[model samples]
Target: MTVRRPAHEPAEPLEERLRKLEKINRALMGRVERSTDFSGNGFSLFQTAIVLEGQVSARTSDLKRTLEDLSDAYARLEDARDDAEEAKQNLTSAIEAVSEGFALFNDAEELVMCNTPFRALLPDIETRLAPGTPFPRIAEFFSQSRHLVLDQHRSPEAWRAARIDLFRKPHAAFIQKLSQDRWIQVSNKKTDTGATVVFQTDITDIVRAERLRRERELDEQSKILQATLDHLPQGICMFASDLRLKAWNHRFIDLLSLPLRLVTPLASFERIWEWAGKSVFVHDGAGVAAVSGWLRAPSADLDSIELGKSDGSILSVSGNVMPDGGIVVSFADVTEERRASAALREAKETLEQRVEERTAELTREVIERRAIEVELIKARDTAEELTKSKTRFLAAASHDVLQPLNAARIFLSLLGGTGLDLRQQHFAGKVDKAFGSVEEVLGTLLDISRYDSGSVEANIVPLSVAEILTTLAAEFQPLADQKQLRLRCMPSGLYGLSDARLLRQIIQNLVSNAVRYTTRGGVLVGARRRGGMISVEVWDTGPGIPADKRDFIFEEFRRLNQDVPDTPKGAGLGLAIVRRIARLLDHPIAVRSVIGRGSCFSIELPLCAPPRRVEHKASAERLPVDLASFTAIVIENDLAILEGMMELLQERGMRAIPAVSIGEALETLQSLEKTPDLIIADYHLDQGTGTDAIAAIRRAAGHAIPAIAVTADQTAKVQAEIRKDHIAYLRKPIKTGDLFALIRKVIAE
Candidate 1:
């Protein structure tokens, strides 16, 4: 069955349908008027209907293409929407990945988004922190939950107002602390859309490090202060505001002699005061009060106090005030300086008293001495005149006395040498011994005179001690043997600056005394080296002197009793002469003795370097065999001495000429057929001295004749005169052997 279409629904083109309908209507009207023209009109209407159907087909194809293009555009729009959603998911993931809390706020100050860390920052209010939550509400939740740890004194309203105010202002970084004492640094940045991005960083480690650095600095400062206090010389102690010992140095303990156990930081000042009062400041009554007062008002400055102790020590104590109600004290010891000042004051007083007494005594002595001085001067003049007379008498008497003695000695010697019976020889020896004693007494008198007159001048030279020892040994050996005593002289190589003649005399007297006193054992003569001097000591096993007599022995004419029967007694002038000679030579003498053992006598002589070598005449000890061929001239003022000298020379087998004066000697030489080999002259001549007579004869003969001066003048002036003439000098009553030796030595030369 075919459905009928509604009239409003047109299935074909309107223009073509409208044209067909119009043609059919026009033909119906015309046929009614003229039915014969209907076939031609129907054909024109059919062509118009065909054109309308073609146009309707083209329009339907164009509408179908437009519908397909609209479907493709809708599919592209769906793809772009999916890509935008994926980009938003990536941005949210990156924000959540950060370790710090991060959040974003919109322009209206509402919470738009936040990471999990931001939510964790406020865990109690994390549920309230969501998108579209206002910042003021979040701040209120943080305050209620105590999440931000804001000021405890501030109200919640104020805290919320402050947070809102900070949020609305231009974004900046600031710090926040949590209620758990963790630190957070908040940094905010404003976006282009007027939202804020906040980053919170935990900074607890940095805060702890800063705190530790401050602590270390404080510790260093404390150490430096302690070191400075310890090095101070003065004892130091510091008390704190609580009136307790806060610090002290080791010196403080040492200075006060405090117990170590009682001293420590925060120790009570009262306890220290009690200990100091009992020990160090035993006598000071103010010590306890001072400590109490210092502790009570530690900021008050105090003056230094000088406190004394029972043990004779003094302490200077001073205190200073600290700004923080504390006290610093120092101590100094001042004992020695105070004592020294007192001693000096006492000495000054004593010295002044002594000076006053001495001055008074001197004033009295000056008055008394004036009266006695006049008498002393008169006595001294009289004594001097007597001494001069004594000297002249001895000089005059020596020649007269010695002239006969010398002749007797020569005759006795000559008679002994001749043929004689034993009895006659014994008689001659006895007489010779008597003459020897007389000669000794006279010689001693002469030596004492020379010393008293100061005529024995010292001719100091460098002489070997060995040489003097050798001579002494040879001279004393016979004496020692006669007494059955050993005499020894130890070899010495030391030299001294001394007068050889005076030294020999001093040693001879000592040795002679030794030999005289000793009857057994030996005498030892030796030298020892002392600093810058040589000690020539004579040790003898003699009848040792008694202690009481030791000092008296050196006095003139003081003798000890002789114990040995066969030992000869001395005139006691030996040691007396020794004392005088030692004094003249400026040498010190010492004597040590034991009653039964022996004695040692030592003389100190200055040590000297050996002198330059000089040609010295060899010592003559014996007559030569050529004595008989020598000729001699004798000049003497005394007839007996002249004959004695002539006979002694002739007996020794030599030609001898006797002349009483220089004129006689000159005449005797002119009458001689040859020049005399030697001249022997007397120093005290009627014409001139022996030296003058010899000079006259030497001039007449036109040559320097080898001469000998025989003089009774023992004065140094006469001896020096003879020596100045280069002639040998012989003392009065000369020994026969010595004269012969001198004659032989001179002629041989």
Candidate 2:
């Protein structure tokens, strides 16, 4: 590059201009002298001298100003040169300070500058990396250098061609692995000045760490696979694609009896198999090619080949090709299994003869068979009492476990009746409600067990529909009233044929359940005649049952709220019993319900002539006697039960007293204002028998006094004893409906 002066500045040096100007002045003076001597005219010479002198002085002044301008321009040019040199030093220092090897190339692709690392990385070409060297030359040196880790599969020519092709790209980054196992990341970036900068970063540590992790993982996997193969029960051997043995467990050697030298690593599978010995099929026309053939070209199917030895041993051989083209073969001894199968076949062929011999003894079995069957029938009939495996563990559960259970319920019920604070009543109500649930579960279980054993007999008979319904209403009205629900019953003079006892129980259960679940509206019981049938429907305004669950509701242990997580109260057996009873009576029951409205259960009964029996239980003349008005003596061997019954009766406004045993009965009677209206005594009392105590109490009162014997033991012996005394018998739980009806009936008689 050349430096040119500005247009207004002098082209020549000030000293040179001064020298030329002085020389011209001297020439003019010489000319003046010559004119003076040659022309011989002093006047002309004098004029020439003045003019020459004046001109010389003006020329001198102009030279001085020209020199000053040149001096200022030279000073500014020097400062500019210094600043350019400083900038160059700063750029050089900055590039050297960078960690990565830096090299800059001009737009012509020629090397402009480079840091120490750039040439340091390529020691072989260090001398060649100069300012004049082109970018392609450096790339060629890098590709051909001994340090370059070239691909073994690729020709050096191809790798070089690709590397050079990428040199001119605007932005490029690639990884270059050195022969020394170092990793370098190289990036080529274009500068705004139409230059390119290459950066090479060493990532040896990171790459080595990653490779180590991968190697460790592969090693662990190898160890795990070997361990699993060694522990396998079957003899196993794995071969590489080349059909050379890669792995084999000791079992393979022992099972096949192969030579140890033939089963070593890199041993040919063909040689190993040959030494393992030839296996021929026990059955003709069943054979397979050598496993080595499958190793060469395996199919997806993995069926096994069976081979038998001369010693009556059979082997099952199976093989599969691995994902990496390796093949694994397994051998299993199935000798025992094969023999057992053959024996089973032989037995089946000869089984008819044994059956014939057994059948021939039929004549002799007649007497003994009847005797065995008779014993089985008797055992099943009294299964609950004798076996203790049915009927809620047979009647024992009802007596032992439920004795305290009944007492708890009674006490809880009595507590709810007391005028405690709101919170106390709420808690007591929940406790009582829980006890009721337990009773329902136990009762339902007992009912299910009895039904299963065919112990519950359905006694079908003629019954008055109106009287039955009136009795049901009277029994459940108090329960409904407690919940502030209305119980509506439409009296029907028309009667239908049904079991009086069971029909009452069915309607009674329906009304009782309706009162229990109904939180609003009421339960409506009405009857309508449809042609030759009477439909006795019970409707309840409660959480309606789903249509899907309508049939399921009658299933034992099934509830209407099965879809929700919350388990609703009730053992889900009420409707189940209803279904069973309806079937027994030849009555078809139907149910219709809406999601939020209510449910109606209708029992279709065949229409029949009115019954001849007259029922005056609901007559207006007889005052509605709820057990609340009467007084009774509660004789229970269990103190808790005695207290619970006394509290329960008194809470309902009855003048009741407690008697723990037979001895307490006399004391309780002597304390009563009037010979207690009724006697409620447990059969298994503390001392002397409860029936004996009841007889004594009756003798003291001078009349029967409406005696009722309550007992946890429902055995035939206990019931017979209570009945022989002419007293009433109720089960352990003492169902309120049955108890109340029995009490009223016994009192009236």
Candidate 3:
């Protein structure tokens, strides 16, 4: 082989051989193209080598390598076909295992293959190998857009490398939307038989998962927004453009005690706002207007409102544009803080007013207290001065007047026993009557002194009013006769327990006043019975008491008359003495009068038990005297009084024995030899009192005789002395009737 013939064969290397084969292939291709026709000839070399002979050798030695190459290519194609079948089976099994349906269709738009799941997706189909089943038949079974692409014409490599994408057409996710509920993927390609390969994938769960993801994201964002609104201090709300409330928080609803309708669909926030604004007219309309003015705010500028709630609460409102173009409002209640501030201001004002008022009241009280203190001091000083003046007057009156009065009475009694003729007796009686008047005036002054000094203690005793009246009649009748005024005493025998001396003074004063004031008309002294009491009245028919002057007539030192013309006068003390005695006896005194009419002065005495019968009889015995057969001796030191006594005795049917001195009385008694039945001694009897004369007369007669000490001494000491001697004492200005009564009593005993 290594000969020359092998050397020629070595001329063609591996690269040269490949070139030769390519050349031969071209030649053969050209020959076949030229010689044969594809139109039913069936004798083309290319077809013959490829299909029938399977030979078109380029070189004898390269033939085996080419055959081997053809074999390996065939083996790979067989393996790929087997792998495609296995993959189809696995895909079918997987689709059946899934919950959804799946289907496969051929390029002819017919059902070629389908899994059990796909059959389930069909309405009533059993197998997938049905003929003439259109590829669009499954469109109704699927819920979304399905695509069928014929990929059977594509080589496997091309199919894998080809760009593919899937998308579900726009459709409603709900089955009621008349869209396919299930989905598939169909791929078609150009092949020898013009068929297609199709795959159907049910994508309903994927569609649902995508929708759930979107919903979860939306829910989370909404929760975030709601949480932010809730955490805000102010209440938030949304309202329609028509002013109807859509939603609200708790705070906005509770602020006004208002019905929900006001801010709800029934009424509206717009109408409620108008009403609330008008109600705020009291606190200045700015607040209400500001709240109501929010309607015109721009979207960027939030509306703000200051609201005053009906429950004394204040609210701040803010509103803004919502994403959906609705009104969103916020409110906060500030009631407690506002109330606290108002209360603080009010308390301050009240405190200031109280301070001012208290200061004014204190000033007024201080001034009033000072004025009262000064007035009290002045009153005290005036009282002291008045007390001193009264003491001096009382002392001077008793000493200067009473001493001369006592001596003159004694001289008058002494002179009465030594009387001569009627002319001499008459002259002596005139002097005695003049002196008697002076003594009577002195006794009245003593009574007034006792009353003013509060020293007149009452000696309450039971006595007969009748007897008292009778005695007063006898005492006052002569005075009444002299004044030409009738003195009538009508007595009621009413017994009363009272101060006897005071009672007598009251009656005497009443009678004396009647005589003094009366010009012509009569005076009356009487008693009448009342309920549990006796009213003793003194009535005068003279110049009647004036109505204006009646009230003050009984007051001390008060005189009803400014002028009087009577010769015998009073010191305006008679009625005053009556009032004082009435008070001392606890008797109520009253007067009734009319201008120019008569006046009546009355005393109401309370009734009490009668005294012993003996005391009553003694009082009665001293009433009126019968001077028909009585005889009395007149003894006085003064000539006038001695003569007056002798005339008075002679007039009373008594023998006259006038003595100018006590010695003359002794001579008369000795000469008479009968020791005259009674001795009439004067207190001023020629330097001896009537009491001294009584003792001297008994000494001269050498026997004790019934005698009377007649004097004007009204002092307690004088009265006590006279009582101690067991002699009757009579005060002067002694009337004829009183004198006769004393004489009769002394002689009868």
Q: In order, how many clashes per candidate? A: 0, 0, 58
Worst ten-residue run, lDDT, model 2?
A: 279-288
Model 3 is weakest, by summed lDDT over 10 consecutive residues, at 169-178
TM-score of 3: 0.36
What's model 2's overall lDDT?
Answer: 0.70
Once superposed on the true structure, which residue ranges of model 3 sit more than 4 Å away at CA?
1-400, 406-437, 474-488, 519-521, 555-569, 611-713, 716-718, 730-748
* C-alpha positional error of residue 687 in candidate 1 after TM-score superposition, expressed in Å: 2.0
**What is the overall TM-score of model 1 with all chains considered together?**
0.49
The models' CA-based lDDT, in order, is 0.75, 0.70, 0.60
Question: Considering every candidate listed, which one attains the maximal lDDT?
Answer: 1
Evaluate residue 45 in candidate 1 and report its C-alpha lDDT on the 0 to 100 scale: 54
Candidates in descending lDDT order? 1, 2, 3
Q: Which segments of model 2 are wrong by more than 4 Å?
A: 1-389, 413-419, 453-459, 469-491, 508-535, 538-551, 564-569, 583-601, 604-607, 613-633, 646-678, 686-689, 712-749
Give lDDT: candidate 3, residue 98: 66
lDDT of 2 by residue, 1-749 (tens): 12344544432453465456567656665665554433547777788677767765765666555455556546545555666678789999999998889999998989999999877886877888889688777777777788788767876677777866776788888878886788888898888988888998888997787666545533543454455456555899888878888888888876776777677889987677654445333242243354445556764324577766546678788776554457778888888667756755565454545446667687655665566567555644654353335443544445665665666555555544544434345655555564565566666665555555455565556567888888788888887887788898997977777777767767776776677666788999988898988888899997787878888778765655433422234555788888777776778888888877888888877678865655666644554577677888888878767776776666567777777877678987787778888888887765777788889999888887778888766544667789987888887676555766777787776
For this target, which candidate reaches the highest TM-score against the unseen true structure?
1
lDDT by residue (315-415, candidate 3, tens digit) is 87666544334666767776654565565567556555655766768776557556655754565565555654564456335533444444455445555
Go through the candidates in order and give the C-alpha RMSD of each one to the true structure: 52.5, 29.7, 63.7
TM-score of each: 0.49, 0.40, 0.36
